[model samples]
Target: MKVMVQPVVRLLLSVPLCVLVACGSGQEPSPKQTLPLLPKDEVLLAADSSKRAMIVEQVLGFELAPVMESVAGKIAYDETVTARISAPVTGRIVSPLPALGSKVNGGDPLVELDSPELGKAKQGYANALADARLAQGAYERAKSLFEHGVLPHKELQEAENALTHARDDVSQGLMHLHNLGVEDEKIDNRYWVRSPIAGVITERHVNPGLEVRPDLAEPLFVVSDLSRLWVYMNVFEKDIGLIHVGTEVSVTVVAYPNEHFPAVVEYIDKLVDEQTRSIRVRCRILNAQGQLLPAMFASVDVRSGPENKAVVIPLTALFTEGEGDQVFVKLGDGHYKQREVKVRLRMKDRAVIAEGLEAGETIVTEGALLLRTEEANEQSEIDAP
Candidate 1:
């Protein structure tokens, strides 16, 4: 009884499987799709054709603005507000070097140096003052003696000349001391290197005992007003015509990828580099938040002159036929015309039309190639007669 029951169950399962296979094999195949009909330069979609296969949109006017993109640039301090602090006299740096990133005023001391040059200048000035005082007394005595005929005119004249020379020496000595930044009150050789501008100290190269000189290759300190900065870009000659002194620009940096810094063209080189055919373009940007730093590499986009209005279309909507450009212009009721067009410019994803198109006209933006294929097939069939 058990063997008979197993055979019946197997038979029932096998019968259902055979029925399913038969049902699938007997079904009719889907009907072949029919393409749109073409008449000369026009295409007419079949009644059963799905309209969603292609995207259609009204043509609109777009302003064509000249732009220089992805230009390599660098951030720098504005020279007008930046000062490179260096020692005027040779000396060993004393204690308390100006801290990096410290805010300072114009006259704030940055470094103190003890130099023999300062001491010598001070001594020379003091000696010159003493000599001038003695010469004045002698000149007065000589004048009195000359008036009373006790001294000869030649002797008085000689004394006057000596006095004049002495006064001149005093003036020279005083000027020297002032040039060394040594005040009259300080008798020692303590020379303080002060900042010439009110800004934050962005650099430092001095230690407590490091020797410094006036001709050091690098300045001991760099103080700059971080509120403004300069950006330098190298622009090639082909695009230089579009840029001018007042052109607007936008800058981006790797460190701050999402932020856009606005800038204006401040300077442009008159001479182009013979080898590179490039010129230096300088721009100024306001950095009130101190987000940009000197030496940071940046990408700059130069937004040149005013833009011209023109009709533009998506690149997908444009089709090439032999040597000319063409697009499918919709003429209502699933009818489209393949019209020749002249492209003024080919951008990344759009084409600027110079002729054969107008604003407010409907055009095929996505399926231009479909119409092109249909027209070709129809032409072949008609020629086969």
Candidate 2:
């Protein structure tokens, strides 16, 4: 009886002793026992009261905004207002040519040329005028003689025919001079090369004493009205159906990144480029202040169709992760989840989300980075061995 009672007492004493040894041992706590468990997509910040106060929350909503398609483009001169000024008649440039960028009015003299052809024309005109006067006097005299029976009728008729021929020669010479831009009062060997339209001389191709002709391949000057410009864009074939002749467009240039110029779609190419599979689009822009320039790189946004309903949020609410964008949404008090969202349109200070978000949901606009940082720290602790 004594032996059985002693063995039971020893077993009871050994159980409490093993429990005390395990509790008193110096060992690190297991992460599963110490760290708070959270859903893979969710994070909790209730432990940090300061972090909760730093976060800003907002509800998503929709707005009416024009649907737009963005494409790369470049600035070009408006062809209607551009002109290549060339000499109308073949001659040497005698007058001082206007300096490049000189503003000129219609008929403004760009060059004065001394041409041998002009001189000969002037001489011929003078000779023809003299002959016409003499012939007219002779015809009048002959008519009077024929009527008074002083001259034969056949001789008077011959004089009248000669007068008609002389008059024709005179008129032909005068027409030639007029075609050469020679004024009747200023008939001379010198011909002034004048601008046909009012604009600034954008290019100069001739110098004083340089011979120029009407058929020269290169122009003597290029005049363009810089008050307006054209932006040329290439649109994908798929987007061509959405564009039209009178759609509104917005343009931006690298030189002026912060500014956007409003424009209108003026032309669309009927043919598609075979290599790029794209269509050419042109937009007319008003540059009353002449701030835009030709050949500058530009970005174009064509306003397509009508406004549509979309989920929109402030731009600040977005955060980038991996190759896509992300945002944080509140699940409950001090609980948030990171979500991947697709941004459709980015405006001045807001963004339109095409996916991964819904209206009336609360998202963290401010202190999003803080939440991300906290999540990273918690992950590190849980992952430590």
Candidate 3:
């Protein structure tokens, strides 16, 4: 039981199909048909916004900041023991080191040595002194005779020369004994070695009866005056000019972060190290609690340069597109241009410009990322169509 369609209904379906076929074959559109399009300015704005602001990449040109006014440095011992002290002559140690870490006066006994060589030096000095006394008397008698014309001038001169030689021998012999640790009063085998300077003993080399020699396998003792110390720091080639003598600076030690010691620049190296490309700056620090130690890894900062306005820009403004750096600056009115700038260095959150933008110029810190992206996209579009 199927229903049959009328002939007029069949004719209406064929007419609608013929219209659809005519439209698909690119026939002109009807009078009311028109293409839709966005306005040119709106299109530009849309395209620019589509490039999108980079994830809130904020940028702003900061006011000219004053050059840094202050800095810091470190403290250390003014002198250092580069080479350890060794026994001058071979000897047998008699007494132990004189009270480790004791503040000793100059010429104080540091250690005592027992050696037959020391005794021999003392005997030689005594013999030389006796000879000098004999020579002096002979010279005096010869001078008197010469004045009276009984002895010749040459004979008196010989006597004087002999006395002089004897005296020199005695002095040399005494010094030799002294070097061997022989003190003036004690004439026994053991001799006392006097300290060279007033300081604390840092190291002890030998014990009693141990043979000491000039060999520097280990130091006998290290003595240093801890009251004053030096802090040495390396300044990079660019930062070296900031360091200068008499500049007061601060030092912070890794060991004591809570405390920052005040120090002054004592020395600035004239030469830069070839390997590290750094110059050494020496700072003098007063060790109040004797807390500062040598090679303790301290940080130093020195205040440098006169206060002046430095042209700066936001770090995000630098677009390293190719070989050069570039930024967009808003000229007077709505005009903006892609500008190339030379960055001096990174400053805090911004960058210093050695060239390019001037102080009064307004730069497009914000929306720069979007502008670059738009420019790149437009270039691609023009090349495509």
TM-scores for the candidates: 0.69, 0.71, 0.55
Q: For residues 264-371, could you state the per-residue lDDT of candidate 1 as single tens digits?
A: 999999999999999999999999988999999998866544555677687888989989999988887778899999987676666778899987788988888887
Query: Over the stretch 1-385, how does candidate 2's per-residue lDDT look in tens digits?
Result: 4466888999999999999998889688776456577766667886657888889999887654445546889888898989897777778877776788799888888888888878888899999999999999999999999999999999998999999999999999999888877886345778777788888898888877899888999998889999988999999998788779999887888788889798999999999999999999998999998888889888886664456667878788998989989999998888999999999888666787889998889999998889889888777777789
User: Root-mean-square deviation of each candidate, in angstroms?
Assistant: 9.1, 8.8, 11.3
User: After superposing candidate 3, which stretches have Cα over 4 Å from the reference?
Assistant: 1-76, 80-86, 140-160, 175-186, 215-218, 304-385
- lDDT of all predictions: 0.84, 0.85, 0.68
lDDT tens string, model 3, 1-385?
8666688789988998999998889967679643233222111224344443432232334443423322234444456522235667667887766767688777677777776766677778888888999999999999999999999999999999999999999889888866655557355566666676777776676777888777758878767787778887777787666556887666778789879687887888889999988778887888868788766777654533435346767677777867988887654333346778787666444677777877566776667767666556555555564
User: Candidate 1 — which residues are off by over 4 angstroms?
Assistant: 1-64, 306-385
User: How many clashing residue pairs appear in each of the predictions shown?
Assistant: 0, 0, 15
| Candidate 1, residue 206: lDDT | 75
- Model 1 weakest lDDT span, ten residues long: 61-70
Provide the lDDT at 57 for model 3.
34
Q: What CA RMSD would candidate 1 show?
A: 9.1
